[model samples]
Target chain A: MSKRSIIPGFRLSIGISVFYLSILVLIPLSIIFIKSFELSLAQFWDTIINPRVLASYRISFVTAFCAAIINTVFGLIVAWVLVRYQFPGKKIIDALVDIPFALPTAVAGIALTALYAKNGWIGSLLEPLGIKVAYSPLGIIVALTFIGIPFVVRTVQPVIEDLEKEMEEAAVMLGAYRLRTFLRVVLPTLYPALLTGFTLAFARGIGEYGSVVFISGNMPLVTEISPLLIMTKLEQYDYAGATAIAAVMLIVSFLLLLLINLLQWSMNRRMTANS
Target chain B: MAGVVRYHATTKKQTREKHIDESLVVRWTLISIAVLFITIMIILPLTVVMTEALKKGASVYFAAIAHEDAMSALRLTLITAFIAVPLNTVFGVLVAWAISKFKFRRKQLLLTLIDLPFAVSPVIAGLVFVLMFGAQSYLGPWLSEHDIKIIFAVPGIIIATLFITVPFVAREIIPLMQQQGITEEEAAVSLGAKGFQVFWRVTLPNIKWGLLYGIILCNARAMGEFGAVSVVSGHIRGRTNTLPLHVEILYNEYQFSAAFAIASLLMVLAIITLIVKAIVEWREEVQNIHL
Candidate 1:
């Protein structure tokens, strides 16, 4: 069987994939590293450490982190409802959950701004309460959370569907209460998937640009996200500064992604072993 | 003895009922929260896009969509998707096929590499291309000397889009192909079918739905991409600007109704995409049940 491969076009497939990946992804991405090298180490450090840049980072990280946390809690609830219970319009709700993935970020940005702008629908209501959503850090969280709603739901939905009810039943048979069975017996099994979803949402939130840019009001050192900072630098013809900031965002997200993959891999291994 | 046994039986039945599902109050409360969250987060924004677009009237909405700049942006967006989606679909197929059909070293690495774009910020995706083919880069001089433009042009838009969306089709198809395994193809080959014949007859039919699913998703993203395309588009109206960027331009210029009018068109596309996706998923599930 090993003497010759049975598959046809194997060589062609491998060749095209490798070549395409190199040109489209690998080669272009390497340019960031090469461009950043042109700046002296101190200059690179200074650009990223600039107070304005630091403020943007703080806003981006804090908002994205909050968005991820929010998504994890509510997304889990959504997933559980979709899996565990039947309701009117369940199918519609299931389909609607994916809108954030399908809708253009630009459209979402405008629509959200209109909704949350003072005197607008939700905004008018919030304004009466002296609460602001549009053109603030809160607005950033709103957009990030909007885009992030899908990640946790999609990740956790399948796990919930596949959950072994027998285990929960067994816990009950042992005289455990309903909430206790859920918290101790069910939630632990879901932790890995939940964490994966959280990181994915967080990573996407950190890099988000189009949706946040409008509603954020883009106030310097106040509402600017890191990705927008990269754009601001590019607009100002500060290639060195842009490259420095882009590189930093890129590395941090890559580490987060690596953690997600590790978690998924271990989860898959455990799943197969159990089966 | 009989009274004692009756008491124990009643308590046992109570425990079973309680343990099986959440109490009615808890269930309804969870449902209410999920519904309320979805309305505030997802449904309301969608309604706003449509209402705000029509706030002026039908004629204004029509004029906004028909304006030369809006028309140009729509055309450019379609063109970019026209180019990017097909190319990426082909690449996705090839990569998915290669990785699933063959075994080699560092296969995990290849999968991770494909996912790299997802992890990277969209702005950075555009920046790398700018750094590569921008006038400031090493190749910039060579490209300019050849009188060719990449960064801040249509080609740059397509390239950045390609970078951002390259993984969608492959990521969708890979696991599917992996799950289906190689048995069917081998069976066809043993029946004296050639490689191309086997693939076309056996493999293609099996993965057709999955491939369509991937293409739909890729098309949606290609058309909707804002951040990366914005970086490379240079925002030249009627020439380089795509729809998302055009929306940004109008909204920033305080043309609220017009901006939303154009945005409503894209939102329609998103809705249609969702509907189509739902149908595809339902059909796939039906097919799975039959199998």
Candidate 2:
């Protein structure tokens, strides 16, 4: 008798998947590069390097970096607390960490605008200190940080939970103080996860548009982000300009995410080896 | 008796001196900081959505969502999600099966390509469609000649949504199925089960929860998608305006109450998505324990 294959329909399934992915993802993404190439080198350089575009790129990168840093610090704290402590409404707090993931970005934008507008709730409090959040670069950072929080918290939480408390106990038993034990024993273990979270947050922040637009005020050469600038170019029917900016974003973000994944893979290997 | 009393005293002293956990002050401080951050960043925004929606009273809020354009926007959002979610769901299952069950060359590259959409900016996702089908492209003239409009129309909205959410279901299911392995299916096949029968009887039961979770997330994203859909939607009121676009129009028109009211509806959907997600996670945990 002929031996039958264990998993049937491999050809059919692979065919459909390859065809669908090519049409929906591969082909469309390639069009961006091809369309951008339609411009000569000088045109591409001018489109991407004009003063306004440069300013927007700077603002996008700076704010995203700042937001990612802030998220790393607070996200670690949040993840640490959720994994180690028992508190009232713990489940709800855990659920709330994912609100940004599930919440519509547009809704987040409007709600944040309402809270931080000069006359809004939080805005009223900060205004006394001459701090403006809504319609400024600060507002853009706030929105990015809000959306990026879950990335850090979720990434680090499982690692924290899986950590063996025995190592910490042994350190304490060796006469290490609380702060010393955490710094030496715990921080090294968490460093890779923290870095991964930071990179992911930074990557997402770079491409974020919906939540940042209303809060950013879109002031050219000031608060304009690369994504918003791309939108403006599209609205004006500047397809080449739009695709050029988008291609730059795509390359930078793709490289950053690839680096992060590599870091994570290596970290996983080290962790399993140590255990 | 004297030795026993001395041992008790030493044990009490050790208990007092050997406390290794964080100080009460430090613990409370960290907890408070976490709570404060969450409140300011997450909780505040959620409450603000509801408060602002009702700031002008319930009647006005109700009227805002009941407006003709609002209803049409709601319908369009539902229609687009209904089409996009199922299409992606089927595609997700097929892709997950291929990658998890079969060996292939360039497997890692295929996986990364699948995730390309997530890394790409949503604006870019929308732009690619326009570049391919807008009035300026090669297909544009041909499609227009046939009276088929893909850009600035319902078809454009659906395509953009599809692109943005294409990876959600597959990403969720691939790892799950990989962990499950194929031994059960292999055994069932060797026992005389047909392809469809084996999948339905053996694989489907194991993956149904994960599939549902993925579908919920994909549907939420499809319904809430703004950036990509906004780029191609043309913002035609009562025509191509999805719910998010409608919120944008109302906000831009200086109708704050109406905008927040419409936003609150989406917020409710977000809440429901989170609840379902939590339940699915809990169910998965229970199943893992059983295993």
Candidate 3:
């Protein structure tokens, strides 16, 4: 009668799901395991931790984390604005939030590169100010931000809209100040959505190449991302190394996301219990 | 009664909504900031790409667009997307139907597997296909012997794009299906409709809007896919290059206007998709209200 009945029956659908999963998911993931199997344990460790590889990992994860954090804070503000108030260009801004989602990563990257490249108008201005953007780690952050903003903004928007305003008014009527009401009342409802958006944007930025590559200038340790490092490894026919790096990324990303998911799950469960 | 609960919600929220109008000015300023970000981040750069694209004049732009390698890349991208999109759509609908309209063991596992593509990099996605279809794997030799090259061929592109994009349609459709109860199907069955007809007439019509949303997302991903497609494409200019790769080639070679011209075309298509998506989403919202 609930989530159960709506889906036909357990056994038959599970059987169908298994067949789909085997073809679609398991075999593909296993092949990565198999490819990495070519290397011994020490070789696996050596392959994944190559200095260039480590550099890429640092740049990618650091910039992605930074970008995700930026998106989380700014995106929350943006979502709050869209939800709590109506203004000129509100619908347009709402529509614009999806640009990063729909835009091609390569295209977005190229666009960012053009905007911030040495001779580019924006880049030219920044260059005169002694602030290098394109062809640096900074450029990588800008590109990732360009592509990942939508994930945070869109994810947070619906939840912000879903929040009941009466609750806010009640707290205000009870003499809680605006910031306190937001911190004590509004923030709680929006936290999980913010976390979800942050996680998704962070995950997206970590592996992002097309957008970052054009802008990063793909320097070995300076601006290169993990995915680009995998590409470089594979291009040099270092199949073992590439798969090893991928496997590491897989394991680490899986663990991290699993943690975030658990966090989200617990939060949702708490909300359900409270309500 | 349930009526009272509904009445309370409508009345309370309505009164509260009017008070919120008097609530904040900073909100609008922040929204304008968001709008500014999108404009600077997205629309401005796009306008630049277009401006640079047109600098060489129309004849040259058309010539660049008509360039054989670019033509082949565009065709190949479409060919792969066309093959992959329908297959994925069918797969998405089946998976959604099974997950939504039926119960299953390890259901969460299945959903997780389906959603894995979103979290993983597409570049890695290409590697997974290569691992299976390249010269090293079990099937690679068989596929190569058949002269049916998949790892570095059209099939490879399709498989890679499909892998990277599988979640798009299914994710879009599931929420709608959840909102839509299966009563209509049950009623159709009661009226003697077979499974096929029940699905053909009853199910498909209801979810068409959601399906379109997924398809647009899938098609866009397929066409614009660079990192994964680039890996598998072998960068063969006339052979494996998709439009994105072509743009990369032209830009790298300093054919700036030509590259932007082609890139601008793709942007036009993207803009069209965005417009269509906007409409469909609006329709979906309207439909939601009625539902």
Candidate 4:
């Protein structure tokens, strides 16, 4: 009912949105979908199931998932520290978390490579210990984790800030130990935000290119990611194949996010009902 | 009698309970992991870039700037940001207007689509533009016939960035609009203000902070975009490559000092944006306190 009050009678704005989104998002996406149609079902399967492509998928998904999981755990901590603790330069550290959000992914990749490559400073230190980070799956995980952490931290930070400290105190008074209180009370409250962060970080990691490519060393089936493989396909002029594989990536990412959201929604509902 | 007993038991619970360990192990562990990640990934890399640039000395730093490609990269980055930022700001406002003001079929779908670039792989975003404009689609033939080249060109690079950055301005403003009730707009309309006037005079001022935040975000994203632009930008020195792409090129070609010099420049811009956002947010908080 209130929606009718806001429309100031302008078709111009609405029309422009339709046109812009059509040309920019829809047309390009349709072409990608249509290109996949040009390939036979068997060819689509073949393209997606190729050893190199399969390897890239494994590298991308498994690494992204792992990075996201790592981010979920650690990002929550960072968020908690920034929100609950007051310390010197805490605001600066809080802002620093968003550096990955602003820094160009490629630049990030280059920087990470410069620092983590065998001859680079950190890599040199780790090399003596037989821990190779750059040009390996470990590098991908690090980059993804770097970019992914901010999502979780930013997501969970506000929730943590707004958390009712009195409730925790009450739980303590009710004889719940600190660990039990966290596991039973705090974790349940933070679950939705955590899931939201996980999905965002996972989605971001899955498609990340610039940062990962530099340190990844990009060996086929080793450090190669799906995005890189898609780029390789485009360079090779295999449009249909690239689109097919990309579609698969897209579907997998969407399904994972949707499933996560469903679980989050159900949890949120249950929490509301219980509280 | 039982209810009274249970209430007394609840009240006495703390008396019998053991004092809990409050070492904050889980919280501290999470914090430690984040701190470690930052130290290894961002802080160390940033230090190396700083060290590399500083080792070159101030004279070398300026000389690196005086280098031809580096200069062009700076100029090209400025040109692209100038072109992309205002366009995105205007489009983003219109998008925010449409999404926030209007209700239609699949409204949430449109919002989701607007956010697609943020979710989708930037590489995929660039690849989609190629598929659309890469001499293969219906428009590809028409665009070529009309001498409109997009892929592997400057325009293609800008478009790829545009796609990746479409959400910032709109996203920043949407929540603000929801938070700020539409009473002012209604008041303006009752005074016989036209649609454009209402937007320009009344609506813009109310949401200006949000708009500024969005513009800053758009500038950062557009300026630093690499994953999306790398696909479409042919990386032609001074021609198609944006600054980030330029940094990547220089680094790949073993121009480490020059790369860090440029990296410092962009880092300066990012830091400037950070400062501006902090000031704006602080100002907004102060205003909220007063109101």
Candidate 5:
């Protein structure tokens, strides 16, 4: 037999794929690193470590962490309800979970701003209680939570569905209570999925801009997020400063996400081996 | 006699536990909390979009969308999607075919690189292009000398969008195609069918639904992309503004009715995307059942 491969067009297809990926995704991304490297070490350090920039980083990370935690808890509940129980409008609720995915970030920002502004619907109720939802750091958390919810729900839903009912039944038969069984038996299987979802949500939250910007009121040191800061730097025509901040966000996020992905992979392997 | 009685009582307890789910009170409480959260987080914003749009009369709402800026924004949004989606579709199919069909070294690395866009911020997506093509870059001066404008123009908006949406279609198609191994294609090749014919007749039919699904999602994102487009678009009224940016400009200008009017249009598109996605999911479920 000749040593030729059975599939034809392999060369052409692979060539096109690599070229497209490089031109469209890889090369453009590398420009950020290249441009940022042009800055002197001191200048780069100053640009990324200034007081306002530090504040934005703090806000972005803290709010994203809080939002991810909140999403992890509530998203589990939402997924559990969808998978374990049947109710009226169940289909509608299931469809509604993806709205944050489908809705434009700008629209989400405006709609949320309208509903949570001091004179707005929910904001009006909270105003009497000395609470502010819009144009504050709290508002950033709200928007992040809103967008991040679907990530957790979608990631964990399949795991919940795949869980065997016999395990829960066995626990119940052995005198374990409902909550105890869930905590010991069900939650372990879901732990990796939940963590993966949380990481995904946090990563998205850090990069988020349009939705957070309007709700945040774009205050310099208080509600500004890292992505918004990048935008501000660009607007001020401070390209080097913008590139420096963007590079830092990119490197940190990429590392964190990579770590999470590796962790999830190992966990998934162990879980499957156990099963 | 006492031991037997105890055994009977334990069996009775087990039966009760098995017969019931969570207690009704607990079940209802979980259900209520989930529903309430969904309504507040999702339904409220959607309702607000519609209510605010029509808060004024329908005539005013119509006038808002019919305004010159809104009209041009809509046109630009469509043009961007129209150009970007097909190009990405072709790339997605090619990449999916190559990665799934061939056994190459560092395949996982390639997959990871494809996923890089998803991990990166959309704002960064816009910034990277500016670095490449903005006036300060090395190529920027040469391009300017040649009278080529990429940043703050239609091309800039398209490039930013193309970058942001790079992975959607490929990510979707890759998994599906990998699950479908190359046995049929091999058989076709042995039967004397050409490569193009085999791909068109055999593989294309199998991946049609997935390809369409990817296209739908990519189109929605391309049209609705705000952060990346916002950076590169330069806020040129009636020119570089996509529908989402147009909404921003109007909202910033304190024209709430016009903003919501345009936002309502986008909301409708989002709803339609969800419906299409739901249908695709249902069809997949049905197909799974058959298999």
Candidate 6:
């Protein structure tokens, strides 16, 4: 048998996959756009640009952005410490990093709310300091940060491990100090991975509903997120409004994902060229 | 040459000592921050789930979990996973086989299309279904005349879960099958093995671990899916409610102990998922080292 034709069922396999995805993913997703088209151009414009809708878009984007930034900094630190340092319970900490990914977001939501509520453990501590966490924009960020914790760590970890130690040694031999070596050599190489992680986390955070809903207090124009707004509209039977807002969020998320894929492709190319 | 070598070694030793002294401080500081951050962010929530669940004592915790609605929610969650995971797995395997074994055009686009669910918001995922099949959609009236309901029903929940889990198994298997190549299958075919026989004997064994890894991940998300399931569930107690939704209802009703109790079950599931994941990765690594 020719190697190319050795495995049969190519036609059957591809046909089934495309048909399955079309039914489950593509066709349903297309409904968002089609349904939203029920609104006139001006009506669609008014629905999306409503102040409450605008506020939600702002809140969701801003909080997700802040959370991604937080994860990028702290996630990089966690990834670095896990890679470079040998601490007691290192394995345990490493395992725990994936908790956010594994845990149901609703569980995380209520658990985090319990921990950060006014009478809750950490919230009680922060209450005396006048720093409210739960039921505020800050709480939204916390939920998002928790949701996104693994993205940066998992994305940057293998890259950090695969990093050439010899490069750092060479820099040291050239009279660069420890700080300089990392800042000049290590940080530059990590930028693409960090950015990719940041984008993923940000994308996830923007659409996050389960975790953020509990902590965000659901206050309209203040704590209301875009996803929650969609939920609210659906609950009110405002299907047109719901699909309109959903369409906008969908477009932004798709753009962000496309960017990440492009970034990953380039990163892979760079690695191959270097090796 | 000997004198120069000696001088170089002395300078290197001196610089190393100084560097260690300074780097030690930086290292410990970073480690402390990382440890403290994780403890607060990850561990504290985990601890709270258990503590709050048991706050009213073990009896209350057990009572909460054994409640009629809670049990039904669990049943519903299992059913959703039971249906969704297998369908996705079959589709995943077929997609992986087609993409990996053949040199095809627009392969990248195919992969991207497969990953489309990962990018989509769960709320949007549910909304898409509602838009497509809900009572207000184009198909809704005709479906109602036929007495068939999709949205706000079990089918909707399953569809949303399937949408969210579409990429898992295929993603896991694709690269693995590609790396393993078609050599073994070709060898089996040359020896007069038939198509299904080649796949069953040669291809399945080589990619089993990755396939399992994918299934585990798909099942985890399938069981834990909240937002997508939530939208279509309609929150009808004991009927459409899944486990996560049950937690939300109990929590919202100020049944704190009950909510956490239900949540604790999911917490355990998540932890078990992590342990299994770690084991799989370790086995893969060990296999690689042996090879």
Q: Model 1 over residues A38-98: C-alpha lDDT tens digits?
A: 8899999999889999999999999999999999999999999888766898888899999
DockQ of each: 0.77, 0.65, 0.51, 0.53, 0.66, 0.68
Q: Quick one: best DockQ, which candidate?
A: 1
Query: Candidate 5 residues B23-90, lDDT tens each?
Result: 87888999999999999899999999999999998998999999998999999999999999999999
Task: Output the worst ten-in-a-row residue range by lDDT, candidate 6 chain A.
Answer: A1-10
* Candidate order, TM-score descending: 1, 6, 2, 5, 3, 4
- Model 4 - which docking category? medium
Candidate 1 yields a Cα-based lDDT of 0.90
Model 6: how far is B278 from its true place, Å? 1.3
Tell me what fraction of the real C-alpha contacts between chains A and B each candidate also makes. 0.80, 0.75, 0.42, 0.56, 0.76, 0.80
**Which tens-of-lDDT digit does each residue in B70-144 have in candidate 4?**
778777777778888887787788877776665567665666767767877888898888887888766788998
Error of 2 at A2 (Å): 18
Best by TM-score: 1
Rate residue A216 of model 5 by lDDT.
Answer: 93
Once fitted onto the true fold, the runs of candidate 6 whose alpha carbons sit more than 4 angstroms away are A1-5, B1-22
The list of candidate 3 runs beyond 4 A from truth reads A1-17, A267-275, B1-25, B289-291
DockQ of 5: 0.66
TM-score of candidate 5 to 2 decimals: 0.94
What CAPRI-style quality would you assign to candidate 2? medium
Model 3 over residues A54-75: C-alpha lDDT tens digits? 8878998999999999888878
What clash pairs does model 5 have? Answer: none
For candidate 6, state the interface root-mean-square deviation in angstroms to 1 decimal. 2.3
Identify the CAPRI category of the predicted complex in candidate 6.
Answer: medium
Candidate 3 versus the native: TM-score? 0.92
Candidate 2 collision pairs = none
Tens digit of per-residue lDDT, candidate 3, span B172-225: 998788667778877887788875677788888888988998998888888888
Identify the superior model by DockQ, candidate 5 or candidate 6: 6
**Inter-residue clash pairs, candidate 3:** A7-B100, A7-B101, A7-B102, A8-B101, A8-B102, A9-B103, A10-B103
Q: Model 6: which residue pairs collide?
A: none
